[model samples]
Target: MADVQTGTRRAAGPRDTVWREPAGIGQTRRARPEVVRVASKAIRKSAAIVLLLALWEVLPRLEVFDPVFVPPLSENLAAWYDLLLSGQLLEHFQASLTRSLAGFGLAIVLAIPLGLLIGWYTPVADLLMPLLELFRNTSAVALLPVFILVLGLGETSKITFVLYACSWPILLNTVSGVKTVEPLLIKSARSMGLGPIRLFQKVILPAAVPTIFTGVRLAGAYSILVLLFAEMVGAKAGLGYLIQDSQSSFRITDMYAGIITISVLGLLFNLLLLTVERRFSTWRT
Candidate 1:
């Protein structure tokens, strides 16, 4: 018994000497300083953007660039304030918002169903791909005249321009999503005797959702770009018109404000989409 105990102790000795720290009770404790360091890094990164604005503000005043083309941040801010106070800025913004939203809504409605159809059906996708590719390649700006001819130079033309530009991305992404459904899942589904509708709902649609959303996001981006271009071509209101009108009138400061507005709108839309993506992608997390 003494020999056995010694042997057992000897066998355990190396393991005991082996350098393993004690296992954590549950989650490993994150160091406070490390956490602070991470947060500080994030702050620094965020502040870099502010630093850029500061440079933009300072550099022009120093005449590092032309004041006419590169106006000071202060001038731009003052311009924005003036416009905001006058309420003309809001009028332009509301008009742009109304047009963009209307066009985007229509594009979403069309793209979603068409995308699903093309994606879920290989033969349909094959048939439609060429035409879609053709149109996707076509410069949306080039169609401005055609839209004007058909719908007049009114809001109708502007809306049509946005819709035409936005539709392609959604349609293409949808096709990608649908066509990408896992074969194994489909096989398993078929074996289990799930009907076409049930298989699509339970498996295909869920799998394709991320792709569908990707398209929607792309469509949102495209709509903004197209709307800006269309408004530049023909419109008396909206942010695009604001930029053109301001620039043409040599109100460089107001032009900067309009550009800033467009940037803010795009950022908000992108943020909204990202939030939606995060909300829906629980399984991924």
Candidate 2:
């Protein structure tokens, strides 16, 4: 009887041990693979950039490239640091940021509604599409002289040029997004007794958000590109001006620093837009 009781107690102890094991241990084991996968993906994605930067640092030191014409990455970083300390970088960056935000904001305000109207109304599309096609083909940089002639070389011309350059992408994308919404979705909404305004608000707008964001991202890039040209042409202060002045004066390291700064700024801006895009596109997930 004692042996039987001891056997039963031993069996119970094993069962209790199994039951007492933490559920979190299993979850942690499962979660580790996912975390590792994400980390590996990130590393793979960053490999090319890392290689390029490594080459930039190495080739310059090896004298494979003339350091005068193409400075080492370290030299550029030093120059960038010096500029930062002197407050010059901040001043130029502020100037560029203000112009970019102004033109980008104005383009968003002007394009989205206009695009919706043109896309939704047949008559409006018929009247405006041809003109848009014509102007869209014309390069914004080519019209620099015309802008200077009219708006002059001040901030007005630069801002307006940015506006013109940024507007097309946003406008065209908005129009496309609105027009390309699924017909079935529209029909279903209508069948449910949804009014035109409610239909647009709920169905069409949400569906078009991804496409519209694509254009906004493009316009954000263009705002910087067009602004650079505008600044290089006449401006006394800006990243563009900094690069131009540095080059003209043969301060090669400084020029590269400015270029790096512009690249960093664009990268940061793109990341910001991507975050905003993701926020608006959570429904797709």
Candidate 3:
């Protein structure tokens, strides 16, 4: 009987360990509670933040870095407070916001239609994409000198430069969005006998909404980035100019404060875009 059993076991291919082991499949199977999973993730994230703060505190306290070169959080806040009290900080903040919004608006106006055109027609894409890529590759800073010469060191020049830099993202995203609409969707619309305009209205635009929004978000980021340089070059007011001036005068606190303000503003703008994206992309889910 033992020999027969051994032979029968040998005839069978390898037994599944998971099925054979007494405590294997059931006990080894994952059964993490939702609470534990959430708690673990939260713990990891909190630990990461705490680690960063600890490093920030320790690095400056040790003076391993030059105090002048690296202003600690406290010193930077003090400088920010001083600027806040003087009202200079607010003035610059407003100027930067104004320029960024203006430039971003211009980019939206120009990029959306162009993107749609390119996405809809292969010929348009073939002709224009090369030129777009060429211009996009060229540094915005390289064009700054020409803009300054043509538009002067005024609000116009600064905002327009921002628009020029920010437009590429919006345009590219829009084109991609339109081009990437599901072929089935287009075919379905055609089978329904939808006209060109109706098809674009019903299928293309809705599908492209997410992509268009992506472009807008990217443009928003570039708006601030380009505005920073614009403000730095020759602006009497703006956060970029404020930072430049502060650094020039060795007011490290003010410089740090300006940077903080810039970061906060940029974050807010990004949040605004994200909110819009979520609201519009609800259908995707």
Candidate number with greatest lDDT = 2
Off by over 4 Å in 1: 1-28, 31-35
TM-score of every candidate: 0.86, 0.87, 0.82
lDDT of 3 by residue, 58-160 (tens): 6877997677777677778888888889998889989999989988998899889999999998999999999998998999999999999999999999988
lDDT ranking from best candidate downward: 2, 3, 1
Query: Highest TM-score: which candidate?
Result: 2
Tens digits of lDDT, candidate 1, 1-285: 123222222232645553323434212443355578668777887898999899999999999998779999989989999999999899999999888889999998988899898888878878988998888899988888999999999998899888888888888887888888889989999999999999999998888888788788888887887899888888889999999999999999999999998999998998898779767664542
Query: Which should have the higher TM-score, number 1 or number 3?
Result: 1
Taking the tens digit of each residue's C-alpha lDDT, what string does model 2 give over 198-229?
A: 99899888899888888999999999988988
Q: Count the clashes in each prediction.
A: 0, 0, 0
Q: Pick the winner on lDDT between candidates 2 and 3.
A: 2
Q: Model 2, which residues run further than 4 Å from truth?
A: 1-29
Which 10 successive residues of model 2 have the least lDDT summed?
1-10
lDDT for predicted candidate 3 compared with the true structure: 0.85
